[model samples]
Target: MLLNDRVCVITGAASARGIGKATARLFATYGARIAVLDLDAGQAEEAARDIGPGHIGLACNVTDRAACDRAAEEIVARLGRIDVLVNNAGITQPLKIMEIAPENYDAVTDVNLRGTLYMSQAVIPGMRGQGSGAIVCMSSVSAQRGGGIFGGPHYSAAKGGVLGLAKAMARELGPDGIRVNSVTPGLIQTDITGGKLTPELKVEIAKGIPLGRLGVADDVAKACLFLASDLSAYITGAVIDVNGGMLI
Candidate 1:
């Protein structure tokens, strides 16, 4: 129960198979009250129900600063204070640089990069005032290795921005006792991958990892838990690779 009696807010938690949902569940299991924020109101509420009573759900579009601010306010109103924030809302567009449309590039950047900024901005004041908090951004191995199997140039650029944002925030917020970090997950099986992965594709991906397997949502969630806990109190501006030695 590293997070006992804490309150954690997870964005993009509506998808049952997403890293955000897994992180929310793990946080709740560790005795933290969760605020599950997603674009879909019903799904968010349903996730909240599954997490048990006292947890809450709110509908928010993180790209909109006002909406993010409102969601933060609502969570504080219900949960008292926020101790952790996991910026896990993201989307991927699997197209070559030449094939990517301007709209698609903007959309990916808006959610992956801008959304992270808005959510962090909305939550930082409370964290600073409390003199302690943790912020985890959902970066990707794509940012490091340029989308080996998951996305394209646009996705890579957007995720790279997340890494930069996390590091900058960590520096600015460390004096206030707020830790900021990013987790770069490799190829993880999720609904975002679209249905089930093909046998050949899976095999090809597995061959590239030293661990010889694709990652699961729990792998990233567990890394997030470590960053959120007091065990990482002295850590900030760090990028934890949950990529199973793929980058190494």
Candidate 2:
């Protein structure tokens, strides 16, 4: 139990098959108390319940700073202190540069970039005072490769911003005993489209990946667990690629 008796907060963790939820479950099994935050109140509570006892869920719109602050306070008040934060709240859009409307750009950037910032801000003070903490930010292979299987130019730009923000935070917060790192996942198969990926499309995508398969939510979650646990205690400002040699 690498995270035994620790308290962890995971954002955007409501979806039954999303990476955030998988991370939450993995952390919980490691003996950590989990705080599952999502935009949907009911879903958040339900997800937490699904994780079993000694966990909680809260409704939080990560794009809203006030909501982020409140969530942080509430978690600390109940769980005593936050030892890890997974900034996993994000959204993506599948559109070209010219096809991206103003609304589309705003929605994608706000949730992926702004949400990460707000949530981090909410947790830093406690981590700083405690003199130790870990933060795992979620990026995407799209940011590194300039495009992903389902995201557009705007999505890439947003995730790229996340990479920069995580690195900068890691550098600034290292002295305070807080580690900040990122996970860049490739195309992960989730319930995003309700199993709409045709078998032919899956085969075509797998052909390009050296691993001969698409990624699952658990693959990225395991990377996050490594970063969040003591295994990577000496690492910070690093970007762990969970893309299965997609770039190679």
Candidate 3:
């Protein structure tokens, strides 16, 4: 019961096989009331229901500051408190630098970088008032290594921005009793990577990893669980890499 009696909000959790949903499930298993936020209200609620009883799902376009504010308010109103927030709403593009149009850059950065900012902004006031909270922003191995197995340069830039933003937020929010951290997961097997790898390709990729396997969504979710719990109370402005030695 690491998160017993906690209330947590996770963005982009509607995707059944995604990291956000995995985190939601893990948090729920620990006795935290969970809110699954997604662009699609129905899907979000469905995901919540799948997590079990007493969880909620809401529609939130994290790119829109107003929407984020409203969603945060609704969650607090419904759940009474917010103990943790996971800014997991993000989008990635696999285009090369030469192929990145202005629109592509906007689409990539808006969801990954701006979304993290706006959502965290919406939740901070609540956390500040409570004087205790944890924020886990999702970064990527692409951000660290300058490229990825699939994501484009813009994706790297967006996730890299997330890392910087989380650190800054952690420094500023720590005094208020809020801890902020980022997770840089490597080549995770999720909807994002589904159908993109052949069995041979996966084996080749695994050879490069010390753990010899692509990361599962649960691997990252378990990391989020630790950060969201009191176990990480003293940690802030940290980047926990869940890459299984891909970056090493």
Full ranking by TM-score: 3, 2, 1
RMSD of 3: 0.6
How many residue pairs clash (N, CA or C atoms closer than 3 angstroms) in each of the candidate models, in the order given?
Answer: 0, 0, 0
User: TM-score for all predictions?
Assistant: 0.98, 0.98, 0.99
Tens digit of per-residue lDDT, candidate 1, span 1-248? 79998999999998998899999999889989999999989999999998889899899999999999999999999889999999999999888989999899999999999999999999999998999899999999999988856588999999999999999999999999999999999888898884658988899878989999988999999999999999898899999999879988
Query: Which stretch of 10 consecutive residues in model 2 shows the poorest summed lDDT?
Result: 188-197
Give the best candidate by lDDT.
3
- Across residues 1-248, which tens digit of lDDT does each residue of candidate 3 receive? 89998999999999999999999999998999999999999999999999999999999999999999999999889999999999998888889989999999999999999999999999999999989999999999999999898899999999999999999999999999999999999999998997799999999999999988999999999999999999998999999999999977
Better of 1 and 2 by lDDT: 2
For candidate 3, the per-residue lDDT at 31 reads 94
- After superposition, the stretches of candidate 1 with alpha carbons farther than 4 Å from their true spots are 194-196
Local distance difference test scores for all models: 0.92, 0.94, 0.95
Off by over 4 Å in 2: 193-196
For candidate 3, give the lDDT. Answer: 0.95
Candidate 2 lDDT, 45-101, residue by residue in tens: 999999989899999999999999999999999989999999998888779889999
